[model samples]
Target: MAEKKIDKARRNFLFGAVRRFKNEDPDQIEASTAECVDLIKQANALYVDGDFEAARDAYRDCLKSDQNDADIRYRLGVCQYRVGKYRQAKLEFERTLRIDRTYQDAFLYLGLTLVRLGKPEKAPALWSQYFNIKAVVVQRELNLQIGLLENGESDPADTIAEAVEKAIEQAGSAVG
Candidate 1:
């Protein structure tokens, strides 16, 4: 009888939590949106002013309000990366990617973090993803470097044109 009662209570609690989450008020979302926008602006201003520490704090506050925001998470990761918190930066970037799989910048930065960690082999997929999203010339240059590192090739720029051609083909496939 005791075990049955305990099981019933657990089920009830779980149901209640799910109900609350499912019925979360629209007003909460609106309020959080306003707060997040303001916080993002402040954080950006701080970053532009070279106040990275303050920017980090502002980004953290934004995350507290809307933990699921991929852009905010990505900005926070960049700030953390600039501050030399590589592991925390990686975690934030990973979380951003989890929220939005198509976030190219997070993948690029995550690849950078992996490179810093001496895991060069793990960077090609992320670099490829970034390339597929945007055709920035700088990113193209970086991709060749990462590809060279992964393949243990000493000449990074040897096949630059060929790699860019392939990357463009891949990017076309992505849009299709």
Candidate 2:
């Protein structure tokens, strides 16, 4: 009877410990997420303050914490670019795109990086791809807006086709 009581006590203790850990797991995860967001905000502030090296270091730290974050990789590449590290920036941008194939800004920056690396001819293809992606996204957004207007959820303004033409013109100017 004593042995049975002891065994039951041990089991109860173990179960209570496990329950406590399970309850705390979400708090730990939330703290980690908050820390990561703080790091990103700090890195962006450093970049905006013209401290490219510091921004790069912070971004590197963030990458160490989350290597799969394509946005951080892209920002790190921009910092590298601002610091005149074209080769490293190019690699970083490439990595960003590898992580997120639909990242349009990475495509633009990669094209610019190629231009800086004296490979102007290579930029055209990237630019073309960037424009194509932009066109698709813009078309999708315009279609949504048009649908909203048709359903009376949005006020009717200019036609969707006109908006698309204007967006294309803007995109062309931006590319040139």
Candidate 3:
């Protein structure tokens, strides 16, 4: 009897909360969302003013609600890079790319981060990848032959096809 009473109370409390939310005005919700936009504007202003630490903190606060925002993530990475926190910057850049692979600026910043970490040799590939994204963007209008792999699907290698098939067969592979 006590457990049943507790469950009823919990259900009533949740329903009351939902009803209160449903009664709130849509404009109120939009204004709340816009607070994050305002924060982003403030962060950009701070960054432009060379106050990277403040900008970084503001960006992080915005990210708490919109964790998947690539632009904000990229800006945070730039702030970290400016503050000489190469590792954190690298992580932010990597996360930005993981969220949106077409983000070219992340590639550029990631390369710079690598160079700062004393891995100059690895930076070229990052730069090339950045250019590849640019090439793809520009190629559509310019009609230029900028070789960019737009998709993961590719024609099977002719030379290794049979050998690879045989090896797979030997290993009892079920790959189609």
Best by lDDT: 1
lDDT of each: 0.67, 0.65, 0.62
Question: How do all the candidates rank in terms of TM-score, highest first?
Answer: 1, 2, 3
Model 1, span 44-126: residue lDDT tens? 78876768789999989977766777877887887887787879989999999999998877877787777656565676777
* Residue-level lDDT for 171 in candidate 1: 51
How does candidate 1 score on lDDT?
0.67
Cand. 1 TM to true fold: 0.67
What is the Cα root-mean-square deviation between model 3 and the actual structure? 17.8
User: Candidate 3's residue-wise lDDT over 28-139, tens digit each?
Assistant: 3211234476788788889778799999999999888667778888989989988989899999999999999988768766866775676545555665665432233322
Identify the superior model by lDDT, candidate 1 or candidate 3: 1
Better of 2 and 3 by lDDT: 2
Q: Model 3: runs farther than 4 Å from truth?
A: 1-33, 132-176
Tens-digit lDDT track of model 2 for 103-162: 876876686677567654455466555644445554454455445544656432334334
Candidate ordering by lDDT (highest first): 1, 2, 3
Q: Which whole-number lDDT from 0 to 100 does residue 96 have in model 2?
A: 94
